[model samples]
Structure formats: structure tokens, C-alpha cells
Target: MAKKVVATLKKEGGSAMFTKVVKMTKSGGNGSYAFEERIVSKDSAKDFFSK
Candidate 1:
């Protein structure tokens, strides 16, 4: 399954410089979740959103 976007990290100028993605999984009959982060360089927010 595709990871769900949970939040975004930004620079001082209100630019999106990074992103946070999350996923949920089951382990040992219990529920758990994980997080992943990606870097979106300056002037690359558009490229990241276009995906």
C-alpha cells in the first residue's frame, strides 16, 4: 500500500523543504505505525507535489 502523507516540514520562508509519510502495520497481533521523511530541496516543492 502507498504510504500516507502525515505532515510537511518547511523552511523559514514558508517553503516546503521536506515531507513526512506514514504507514500502519500489524505486528504480533498488535497495531503499529511507522514514519518516513524525504528531503525536498529549495525550489523543488512543485516536483514533489507533482508525483
Candidate 2:
């Protein structure tokens, strides 16, 4: 399976920031995907995607 990392944005204390990790891709592949809005943390999200 291809691996993918997604980071979601959220409004916290009147500031916009990454607040959660949406999903982690198991395998790596070049593909496109469409997603809605969600709060994803930056640290956890880095492993799946990029720094």
C-alpha cells in the first residue's frame, strides 16, 4: 500500500494551526486525492508525508 500523510487545519484560540493528524498512509505512491477540512497535527503528519 502507498503511504500518505495528511495535516488538518483548525482555529484554536483565534489562531489557525494544525491541530490533528487525519490519516496515515501505509504505502508510498504518487497519487491524487480530494479531502474535506479537518485539524491535523504537524509532527505526527510528517511521518506519512513530508517535513
Candidate 3:
């Protein structure tokens, strides 16, 4: 099974511009894990903010 997490990106005013969903997987028994993040299609900030 995989674990999913949601993260929000906010501007200086504290308004959310985008949300990201991360997929996490446990690697070994040593408390190691891997993660993969993707932008939510309907809420991606890439088009609204400049890097």
C-alpha cells in the first residue's frame, strides 16, 4: 500500500494557490521512505505563480 499526502502552496497573504499530492512508499525496515509529488490538475500553481 501507498500513503498519500496533500500540501498547499500559499502566497504572502496566506491564500492557497495550488495543492500537491504526494505518494510515499516505505523502503526498508530502517524507517526509510521514498516520495513522489505531483501537482493537482485543477489546482496547480505553476500557471499562477512565477518562480
- Highest-TM-score candidate: 3
Report lDDT (CA) for all predictions: 0.46, 0.43, 0.52
Question: How well is each residue in 2-21 modelled by candidate 1, as lDDT tens digits?
Answer: 22232222235444554333
lDDT of 2 by residue, 10-32 (tens): 23432244554455344436565
Using Cα atoms with residue i matched to residue i, what is each candidate's TM-score against the true structure?
0.26, 0.22, 0.33
| lDDT-based ranking | 3, 1, 2
lDDT by residue for model 3 (1-51), tens: 122222223335333444666666778878889886765544554543332
C-alpha RMSD by candidate, in order: 11.4, 11.8, 11.3
Off by over 4 Å in 1: 1-36
In terms of lDDT, the poorest run of 10 residues in model 3 is 1-10
Off by over 4 Å in 3: 1-18, 28-31, 42-51
Clashes of 1: 0
2, model 1: CA deviation in Å? Answer: 29
Clashing pairs in 2: 1-27, 2-27, 2-28, 3-27, 3-28, 4-25, 8-40, 20-39, 20-40, 20-41
